[model samples]
Target: MAVLTVNDLCKTFGAGTARSNRVLDHISFDVRGQTFVSVVGPSGCGKSTLLNIISGVETHTSGDVSVTSDEGRPARLGYVFQDPRLLPWRTVRKNMLYVQDKDDDQARRRVSTYLDMVGLGQHGDFFPGQLSGGMQQRVGIARAFAVEPDLLIMDEPFSHLDAITARGLRAQLQDIWAQSRKTVVFVTHDVVEAVELSDRIIVLQPGGRIFEDIPIDLPRPRRQSDPAVATLQAEVLARLEKMKAITPQAATAV
Candidate 1:
């Protein structure tokens, strides 16, 4: 079943004014349950704006958007932004616990499970200020997964970190996603990262149009150094160059 549906969606900053800007143009896609879909485009292609609309932070100018839970209930969403956004005063465990609907044992167990998946189980009691930037991002990722959201929205979660750290987190994310298989809509400017993490990559054009919807059919637990992974990443970059409007960020380092 489709967890998220967007039909002919469009978002314009100033709908009626002369300085109108339409970020997303007739965008349409269906994210089925358990699928990892990535929206990869150059800067100013409305990647983040599309995410904001999907998460209800911004309203669409036209068309329809819907999110549905598998069990006929209200849909739940979890978000991981570029910044970790953890409270400095709270412990890692408490920071995660604060977002839960209940403080029961089941909730605690789920929090612990996701923390362990991100390799932060031992540091749960530590405050965010005590951890490094990478660890804090892990907490954010763990917190998002702990909620068991029907759809996970990630907006360039690794963009702030150094290249080495970003690569490590990508590997950990893939491992964790392998086990959880939560539906994810990840937005990134990196073709290499998109090819590594996504089951399908949705390339957006300069004016927020869907340029290409490509399926990634490689095996799980892929690494950046793997021959096949590198090959696919190169091929995707090659095709994106044909667009001519692909931003300089397309060659973002792996």
Candidate 2:
């Protein structure tokens, strides 16, 4: 079932001027439930633009963004941003429930379960400022899960964390996704991160073209040092580097 469909997406900045730039051009993709899809591309290749479009945070100049379930129902969305984006004054627990309307027991139960799942049960009352960067991102993850969204969109949520912390969180995220059975679209710049965390990796080029949509068939609990995973990582990064070299500068010009 297609949980999200993006058709003919295009985005341009500063149109009809010297500074104009065509960031994303005619991009399209779809994702199904319980699948983890990661996107990688060179810097300034419009990865964040695509994510913003999917979340309806940014409107495209052309194309359609649709989120429908397996049964064609409207899919509920949860987004975890790169910045964590938690309210500074609110404690972790309160921030998680900021979007909820009722004191319904079900909401409370869901929030509690997610907080524990993210290993923040004991730190629910901690402010965002009091937590480390990784812990703050965990709170962001917990907040997303608290809503029980059908599709979760994460934009490099662990990019700023230490290497060891990022590795641990990647595995934790996989476990959470497995247990929750939610479709996730993750955006990142790290080749190894994409390989270790995604079932399929979509490589975007300078013109917003998908150069590669490689499926990682390696078994679960994939390690960064594993031979097969390492090979895939190298291959993907090489492909990305090659694309950067081959993309015509004219295509990006407005």
Per lDDT, the best of the predicted structures is 1
- Candidate 2 has its poorest 10 consecutive residues by lDDT at 245-254
Alpha-carbon lDDT of model 2 = 0.83
lDDT of each: 0.93, 0.83
**TM-score of model 2 (CA atoms):** 0.90
Summed backbone clashes in each candidate are: 0, 0
Report the C-alpha lDDT of model 2 over 52-80, residue by residue, as the tens digit.
88888888898898887665556678989
RMSD of each: 2.3, 3.1
Q: List, residue by residue over 144-227, the lDDT tens digit for candidate 1.
A: 999999999999999999999999999999998999999999999899999999999999877789989999999988999899
Best by TM-score: 1
